[model samples]
Target chain A: MNHKNALTPWLFIGPAVLLLIMFSLLPILVSLLISFTDIDLIGLGNWDMIEFVAFENFIALFQDPLFHRSIFNTLVYVSIGVPLVIVCSLSVALMLNYMSNKLFSFFRVLFYVPSITNIVAIAVVWGFLYNMDVGLFNFILNSLGLQNVPWLEHPFMAKISLIILAVWKGIGINMLIYLAALQSIPRSFYEAADIDGANKLQKLRYITIPSLSYATFFVTVTTLIGWLQFFEEPFVMTGGGPLDGTMSMALFIYERGFQYNEFGYAAAASLILFIFIIVATLIQFTFNKSKEN
Target chain B: MKNRFEKLLITSALLIGGFIVSIPFIWMILSSFKSEREARTMPPTFWPQEFTFEHYINLFQNLNFGTYFTNTLIIVLFAMLGLLFNTMAGYGFAKFQFKGKEAVFIAVLATMMIPAQVSMIPVYLLLNQMGLTNTMSGIILPGLIAAFNIFLIRQFMTTIPNDLIESARIDGAKEFRIFFQIIIPLSKPVLAVQAILTFVGAWNSFLWPLIVANDQALYTLSVGLALLQGQHSSSFALQMAGATVMVIPVLILFIFVQRYIVEGFNTTGIK
Candidate 1:
């Protein structure tokens, strides 16, 4: 290539590459470095005051009860939310795929509304629905002669409530992913199954389910990573409240780093969360690979 | 008869499911129109006892809705600057042969795995050092060039015939001219998809803006609404109104561009 031609490409890409390095690439290393130091708001103003106490923050994070609670909460969220989202989204996709009517298309859009809407708005609305006295959920239960349930007040219930909202918000995109995958499956496979006198359930199990494996894998990874860093729902809904019932690792990081000004400690917690995500993702990849073999 | 029954069963199931999925949105919009007393009433009336725009009025008058809306618009609009630069980079990657290209592209892709939360604290500190904290630029700067967008655009551009660019070059056309005159027109579909996705993401973004812009005057709608929920904890009507105001624009945008958004998801699988 000519000198001018070689320079031309750099002209186009240089600005973005610079920004990416400054903002994204640099920050990862900086945050990692920050995790080892004893940095707080005061230290931020005076860098000399920050101490490089190696592994101290990490060790403290492991011992801290609040950190333990956040980890457990995040685990509960992923464990419940991932499977429920996949199953529910796939089920909805299957049901929608069975019909091709205009009404069903409308329903497809309806289901997707939550995914696109702002999470804070969703949290606020759901918070009202879960309100103690005049909430719609309790109102319905009262009409049926059942007692009111503490949706966000009880620690255990708060976790479940967050998962429910998360699943609802999450189902749309995964459903569409599955729907796309489902639509791509060749009809001949199902037709052949039918010709062999295979019932609907058998066709679904043997043909449809097997065909959706890749889409399932995709959904599982994305949703798993998403729920692992579960923050916005609980952040807006509970503020990790009711005795830290719904404190996600992401929220915990935000609370420690920003709320308490414990930047190094929060950085340690965030790094741990990042490691958990990478490990979880790698585990899924290994399991999928093993299954394929 | 069995076929008809099955169809009926499927439709009813979808109908019930759709209603259940829609209840939150339904409740939000309906409650936004309800008076404070009616909104808070036990065994809450599904329909407003009386239609009222008072909460919305209150949102604008008392809650600084106008400032929040304007701030959100500024951030989203400024963030679109990334799209231009990303498209240029994507084209460079797709069409040009350059040294260390593979390494650079892989580096960009690797950054995607590092979740935003990891970098957020440092980014905040960086902004603080630059005296950008509490500024709209602080919120807009970090999101200006996403690796995913560059990746998406490059993938789309690779499908464009190289012969078109080569012929332009043979005709003594400059690279920038070929890009603007020939390549850009062809890449409109991908550009549209990126623009829509970027707009939705910037509009709905919360945590970063919340962290960066602690000044109330700089709050985006999402951040403002979250704070509103906390400040007006008992004001159901006002909170619903704030939410309604925040959600309506995106919903309207979605209705118009629903096709491209869904198509974007199908093609990219990133949403």
Candidate 2:
């Protein structure tokens, strides 16, 4: 009976552990292995054809201009998009705190709807909205007696457009997160600030912002990681088009692995992406730690 | 005067932001009912002069969106079962004090940091090896028990009072019975939260489905919509119709249960 009790826990967790190992852990190891080889579609068919290239893929990837462009695009994306999302969400969350519950819930749903919709669908609508001739933005410009700006057609504008789409889909969850953190803040801190004759901005700076450091940190890290792996919107909206303007690292990797069937090179790119994410996350954590100190 | 001014400021800000935020959704729905020409017309009309369901009919006729919808439902249902299995494991971790449990939990948590992009190709290859590629099971297999979902369930289960489980144990209720009956029933709120999120996630999932399912019949709605867009790049109305089909179910679900969805993210953000 004691033995059975001991085994019961494993019985419960066994299936999940097994699946996690088979699907996640093993794949992670295999991907690392594959990154070192020339594992194309042909090698996928015949294991014997797989040749160990030992960082040759990585070496080749570094020389690949598209890979550099993808990395640069990803950095530009994460740098701009993450902060914009954070600031927007945090501002909305702060304002939300001042509203009535009934009104708050209404606005919450409005902000969150885009995030919940499929990116493919959002991309389609945005495509119409960004259409040069008949797109909504250009239409708005025409109505205002302004020359229509090529939104997705121009490389710089395409990156900005994709960033805008990302922030639209990303802000809801982060806003909700900030709201959660704000509500958890003790009321006395604000009351004390008020008694001290602190202005709203002063109180927000001294009290609210400091109080939300953890939420802000978590949001920053997660959103950065998300932006780093950005793919769908660019894929759907631009197809990484107009000279690979919106081609993200993740999309580049997808094109390599799936479209190009350069699985080994894709694996190498994925590992590099993985390393960048880890480094970024670690930097954020260290930054947070130093600030706390 | 000052308080009223501040209130007005906040209200206007929220209203303006809300309008901007809701534009895509409003456009998707309104454009779905427009003629293709009107949808693509310059200075795009805010309201369709004449509403039409032709695009809706066309989506089903040409795109066979119904098959994709059914395919998504199958994947979602199977994935839900897998989520329940994950929840059970979470319960075990929460209640049972077993050796190596902390290590296992940490291991699960650590896996969350490794982006799916890294493991995706290898996993796809593995699925191909198992002859699961291009099948619904292929989509369902890797997602069967996500580490993050397990972590979420564990966090929620830790909150369940131990007395109920202890009493059931005293009565000689089997471990599985206690888990299924006492623990699960008490965990309805979190379970509902997970259910709503999992549903939205599975429905909106794009990349993996795009990679795995080559058969058009087995394509999920998101993938199918992308395919529709590729095939009819200029048919704004038809694409909006496809987008509508994909968005409406989740949008409706959000309207009904958004509180749980918000609370879920508030507590356990894809952390």
Candidate 3:
């Protein structure tokens, strides 16, 4: 290393490092402290009104039915949503990579357009599609002599509606990742499989799936982490939904923090969610490690 | 011939896939031009029989979308500029060794796992104290120092041969000169990748801005759109118009930067 290296890194990184610590790291540390104190946004100046609350916020959250419901809904959303998104994306990816025709390239762009577009627009348009009377879905059902289903109005259906939109918005991205992975799988393996009299389906089953497992794991874990923090779609579309069927952990935290100004309680809830993500990440990392061996 | 049938099958699959994907976009644009009454009809037509720009006009007047558009642009530009400076620091971490470098790197990466949810209140409170609330700087300050961006640039810098830097040093170049003249010149691909990722991120950001930029005039595009929805309900045409407006800019950006966008993810070293 050059002699300048001793002085250079600090000189280069000093400003950024200071900023990250002060703006990002320091705030979270401050939050951990605030989570243990009953500090509301009454514009803090004197520390007289604030006092240590200990595990009271967490304890209260645990007792609250909304918190429990939020946890349940978050899990259900992640469990179902992640897999569906993965499958949809992976399928489209495979198809896009099945051949390099003009049409395939066009399909790639088509599938990806949704992923790149504004998600708020996606949620808004979907809200209309899920409208009970005016929606095209009901129109199709009515014309087909079937009963009109309320996509967003009902509890279970509302969850499904949000899932459908989420899948559409998300799948295109996962598809591209899977497509990239698919491209890297060696052609020689397929040639050998064909010579060994393996059919297309058999080759795909043995070769494609196993080869893409790493990408699958990566995609699923990231998607799950994102979904666990689900806020926008449900917040916009359902507003925690009919009978609290779709309240997610992130939205609940947002509501408690911003709406109620119950800072400590929200902080506790945020920590709980943070811990869930960490545990989930650890489990997946360990799983990948074992698979590697 | 048998090949003809195979081609037909593949072509059919592509057509169906394209249709499924493009329907929503087509519907979104189509519905935006329709009157609210026509838009809510059960049988959704592919196009408006009588087109109107009223919804689009209404958005500019009612929601103050021009300010939002400007706000998003300013935030995106400022964040990019801030990150460009940070990229210099990231290169230092990898290429320039110094005291406590490893510790600092580890510290930054460790903070990635700490979710933004926990940081929300304190950052807001901190900015409130500093009197930066409702300003673009408030939104941009926390994001200016990105651990991930630093890590990314550091990794990319490590890939450059030490011999190149050594030769530059042998030529009697100053430290800053080598960084600007040598390292920066060699780092185009990664710089493009980083810029696109950062741009998209700043453009789509919602939650932080939602908390900080409380005033309607100060609202960013995503926040503004959310507020537009809350303030005016049942104006399907107006919302679609607003949604379309919000989507177009990023869609245009993606079209130009598609290669860089994909390469950004590719550079993650997932394999």
Per-candidate clashes come to: 0, 0, 0
Q: Model 3 scores what on Cα lDDT?
A: 0.82
Docking class of 3: medium
lDDT of 3 by residue, B30-103 (tens): 88999988997757776798999999988887669989999999889987877777788878788766668788
- Give the per-residue lDDT digits (tens) of candidate 1, residues B22-119: 98888999999998899988768888989999998888998898999998898788768888889999998998998999999899888878887898
Candidate 1 residue lDDT tens string, A1-293: 33345688888899899989988888888898999999999999999999999999999988999999999999999998899999999999999899787788788888888898899999999999999997888898899999999999999999999999999999998999988898889999988988999998899999999899899998999899888889999999999988999998999999998999999998888889999999999999999999899
Per-candidate alpha-carbon RMSD to the true structure: 1.6, 1.6, 2.1
TM-score of each: 0.97, 0.97, 0.95
Q: Residue A110 of model 3: what lDDT?
A: 75
Rank the models by lDDT, top first.
Answer: 1, 2, 3
lDDT value, residue A105 of candidate 2: 85
Which candidate order results from sorting by DockQ in descending order? Answer: 2, 1, 3
Best by DockQ: 2
Interface RMSD of every candidate? 2.0, 2.0, 2.3
Which lDDT tens digits does candidate 3 get at residues A1-293?
34554666677888888888987788877888888888776625656888898988878888999999999988888888988998888878877776886667667777887876767778887887777988777887888999999898888888888888888889777887898898889999999998999987899899999999999998978887888888889888888989998898888988888888877778889989999999999998999889889
Tens-digit lDDT track for model 2 on A116-183? 78899999889988888778888777878999899999998999998999899998888888888888
Cα displacement (Å) at residue A235, model 1: 1.1
Q: TM-score winner between 2 and 3, please give it.
A: 2
